[model samples]
Target: MNSEQLIKSLLKQEEGDQLEFKLVVQKDSIGKIICAFLNHEGGQVLIGVSDDKKIVGISDAEKWEKELTDYLNSAIIPEAPVMVSLEQVGNKQVILVKVWAGSKQPYIFDGNIYFRRRQSTVKATSQEISNLIHNRQKNEFHWERQPALGVELEDLDLQEIQKTVDRSINESKLDENNRNPIDFLTHFGLFQNGHFTNAAVVLFAKNPALFIPQARVRVAFLEKGKTAGEFVDDKLLDGNLFKNILSAQDFFEKHLHTTRKFSEKEWERQDDYVVPMSALREGVMNALVHRDYSLPSASMSVIIYSDKIEVFNSGKSPLKAAELKKSHLSLPVNPDIAHMAFLRGYIEKIGRGTIKIMDACKTAGLKPPKWTTTETSVKLSFPLNIKLGGATDGGLVGAGDDNINIRIDGAIDGAIDGATTRTIRQLTILLAAIIKDEGKRIPDYKNITDLGSVRTLERYIEQLKDIGFIEFKGSAAQTGGYFITDKLKKIIK
Candidate 1:
């Protein structure tokens, strides 16, 4: 609507949530009114209109606008933008002061908090002020600040702390002064009064789940849907939050379907998830940072089915589905944990998780994840992009793994990103061993790869399977061994 039309429409209405009227521009009083509007739904304070709806226009519209804008900038803490325009109504000029509801909130004007209540602008009560402070401190207070019982400084991993410090320093998220583990922890408030807070333990503890066992993640691969399915793989991931994130990624990678992006040259090929890795990573990180840790009986879980993959976490998100789907507000259940995670780079930015996930899915040419929530739990379902053997509506195609078609074009490429010298060596050895001695146990593969750690061997196997280079023969009831897939051979030639 035009300025005059808008003014006329607002004139006929009573002042309420988004409407306010003022006779003259009182700098201090107007600032408080603006603060109230910002704290609530955005509204306009119409100058030249009185409290009783009298249309006594301001003599100099420009003068009132300049004065109010100056006062707002100088008097408001965390200066917020305001719009002031002179509009003509009949023969007189009216000043329209527009304020937007702030996302970076708890706005203060002239040392006082103000809020609007149904046409009335008033000073914020003590309780209201407290609530605002608490909300802002979501990451400042909570489990992250509380000391973990029976946990000591030595129990934490100094290497992880050092890595976090180095990266955070390079990113300028943290200063270079605190380079040591203890100093870094102290500076970030991870160490409170000579005690390690629960956040410190969760981030750096050798075994974080020792204190909070339910903090671990459980991942499963199922042949059917949510209700019932033949379990292909089920494992509990335990360790620090960082470890759990890595383990969860490994678990998902092994189960999620991938499609081949064949290159013009036979050897030049790329493999990727149809749903995108970014979306899955975001979902897992959300489950870790925002899950309710108070419920000891509940644990975070990821379940894969033929049609979709569901990531479940204990406790319902305080944020409504509408809020997540719209505003992208950052209201973390464990703010302290989130704060550390942010500095450590577990999360890219605050309040952008769901939006990132949606965008990632869209970019990958897939539908966005389906969100489901209960009072006790929250679940995110990402539908598998590929229709497994022409199965569309969550129904299985047939017996045997061949029913699910994984179109792999070539053998595993050791030259792919993140392939170090040792990794390449391991891969070359494993591939040769699998080709030379088919259907051998992991011990035999380990001997050929010369990778002593079982965990490391398992990780490489998972990566190989994820890229469609190899498959395990035999079942849970019988001995199984890794073997190169036929698809890999088809492209290798």
Candidate 2:
């Protein structure tokens, strides 16, 4: 992929030593430069360029070429070394060294991991290096692959595993007769070489730490967006994914309440589809679907606040989040986890979770959640239903079950663009009024609608028409209007 353009493109962003250019005249210094970039924000070290980027091309690029190759071979295995390439730029052949912000934090070289300080490579202070290395072993902490030493597979809770599989299959709508626990595990790619992968065991193993430590999910219900706030609630989820997922669901349901009905309107219990429920549910689904099972200190997290819920899991997304939102890509960091979620009906087929999320929010009259995946974590924000003890609409307020519709409406009010909000709201009202023969057509808005004047209703109809959310027809009927393209229909179709 456009390696030259990639380097030039990154220059558009604010840069520091995170992306520094180095003139590697001495082949011996290549290893240290590799360590510096790997241990930091991951920069490009252009070999032939001067500090000012002048094209003082290397006389013999092959010296650094051999050194670069040897450096990778000598670096720690698994994570290996930064990716390096030689390219010609403006008559000068520059060796482009691309290092990822290494997932394995502090990279040790020559018995010492060197950190870059304002373009200077310095050995890490003892305390700093200890902390850095301590945090580096996230993805390397594969518990299932290691033996529990004396522990056997019998150490697992078979009965619980059976229950989990049954529940997952039921939730997923799979044929019960065809899916056994082992079979389901195999289908999810959790089973490998006669044994379950670490991820599989995290989701199903009785005591995952028996062989693999750090296989638990972390859930925190916070206030004020910080951990020190009133510990709204906290939990360390264990057992298999099935049990853990369902348990997480139950935990929030207990703390987060919704109204039995939104309005005194008889259609209240009729599934107006409040977004918080969907948000809470999807947040867990995303965590389970994307979390990196190999990461130790980096674990799955679900943070619930008074105003919003933020869900995070380990691993940088392979797809830019903008692409994920636009395309139907399922680049799962943990395919086994994603497959398990798919089978359990936690994730939709065709990798259409984002689409469903958008659809659900539109249907619920709530805003779709925003997606942002970074190098360290994947985050989703579900807007809070109630703010400051009152809905954003300024009607009702309170926590738990008393305020559901308010939150639902608030999300829509806050998230969508102005044009979209107006168009969708009009469609919702019009569709709600339409049933059997009780409603008017798209162009008949002025008469049948209850939101005020004929002229105002006509303006709304016209706006909807121009926006492609509505179309009109017929026999010179001035007041005729209809929801030709409601957001929900548009989303699904």
Candidate 3:
């Protein structure tokens, strides 16, 4: 409901198990009420309201909002989900602190368990604490442990299973005795009671989509200003988890451009992709390892735009968005899947993937990647531009006598006046290569430019040729190649 409607409805209710009213911001009293609400059914605490239910607004709503939010974030134990906002009730403003029923219950406050007893908040009795703990444990179910109804060992890829065993053994993540595929699966809890679990199928099945269609990753490459339906290229990848990861990386390599920077201090060259490849790998791996496969229609996706790359997964993160930036506990939604990935060295057991992504970006002089969460999914975005180093004047510069320093800015159009740094570099490299060798073939251009595909190289060559910078100098039957035109040679010193 809208804030106005919600506040109007809440105003008519008396303070009880699901609602509380306070005349001012009493930090201790509000903490107890929020803790009790988390332990029981979720509730709301409204500040600036009298004990008689009058809307006596606070003196400064903005200041109270931040003060209460900071208090809740710090005072609460285990970091429960609490939302604090300012809402208007009639002509006055009130602070509303909304708390959700904690999935990990027994939320503690000041070394005690608080309980909501009808209309009052008090310390929980011993029996109530025991019941909360017992209920939490009883309701915890791991979906990955469930049996795949018709899946068999033969349906899994034996070679991939063997590879995992070898890699895990080499990495000391698995014992030598578990080298066999069946033993490896059993050790990792993928095989129970002589039946294959869903994780086994997800990790090693030849065609996981046949059994669980949601076990797929969709990738798309879109040019700047393009809609979702208008894609430069896209693919739906389905197979074992390892295969999908590798395939997605290959797709990224195909579409993403690499930038080369020459370091004058080291007298060496360094090459980096537009977006850090390691960060993208971590993003994809995290999406797969933590995905909620129980939602049959939900799947992961990687959308590549000209300016940013977005990696989206099916489930909301266990921690809040703010918590992800700081140190938090590792709470994997699919433990079995995460465990297998860990053993294979694809991911670590500790919660450091987000940190790794941010670090990679910072080291590469790019803006830090952003993580956004919603009710049903989480998305990680890597902006392609916004560099922190190199040219600060928003124009290209020369690093050395023979090296040109190209830095990507916010512009993405491919025109001469507004071309992306990568595009300009490609065109310049192609022309320089032609100048060095008078008759350069397409293969030679591909080798020198290191563009992902022959089609991309040809596009660059065509752009140069159309601008009267180069020309073809041979017939169809004879040996032919592109040669620099006099128009281009006149500019060369």
lDDT winner: 3
Q: Is 1 or 2 the stronger prediction by TM-score?
A: 1
Q: What would the per-residue lDDT of candidate 3 be over residues 1-493, giving only the tens digit for each residue? A: 3345556667788888888888999989999999998888778887887777778999888988877767775676644556677877678898888765665578898888999988899999999999999966753446677788788877999999888788766644455787888887876668878888888889999999988899988999765434435687778998889999999999888766556643435544466676789989998998998888987888899988755789999887887777776433444677667656765778642455776787777766666788899889999999755211222211122112133222221111123554444565556555655665567688776765455489887888888777677899886456888987776555443
> Where does candidate 3 have its weakest 10-residue lDDT segment?
386-395
Better of 1 and 3 by TM-score: 1
Query: What ranges in model 1 sit over 4 Å off?
Result: 1-141, 224-229, 262-269, 387-493
Against the true structure, candidate 1 reaches a TM-score of: 0.55
Alpha-carbon local distance difference test for all models: 0.69, 0.55, 0.72
Cα lDDT for residue 221, model 1?
77
TM-score of each: 0.55, 0.47, 0.54
Query: Model 2 off-target regions past 4 Å?
Result: 1-151, 159-194, 209-213, 224-228, 260-268, 271-276, 388-395, 400-493
RMSD vs true structure, all candidates: 15.7, 15.4, 15.0
For model 2, residues 2-100, the per-residue Cα lDDT tens digits are 335444554453435655666655544666766776676555566675656556766667666656655564463323324455666556667766554
True-structure Cα RMSD, model 2? 15.4
Better of 2 and 3 by TM-score: 3
What is candidate 1's CA lDDT for residue 69? Answer: 59
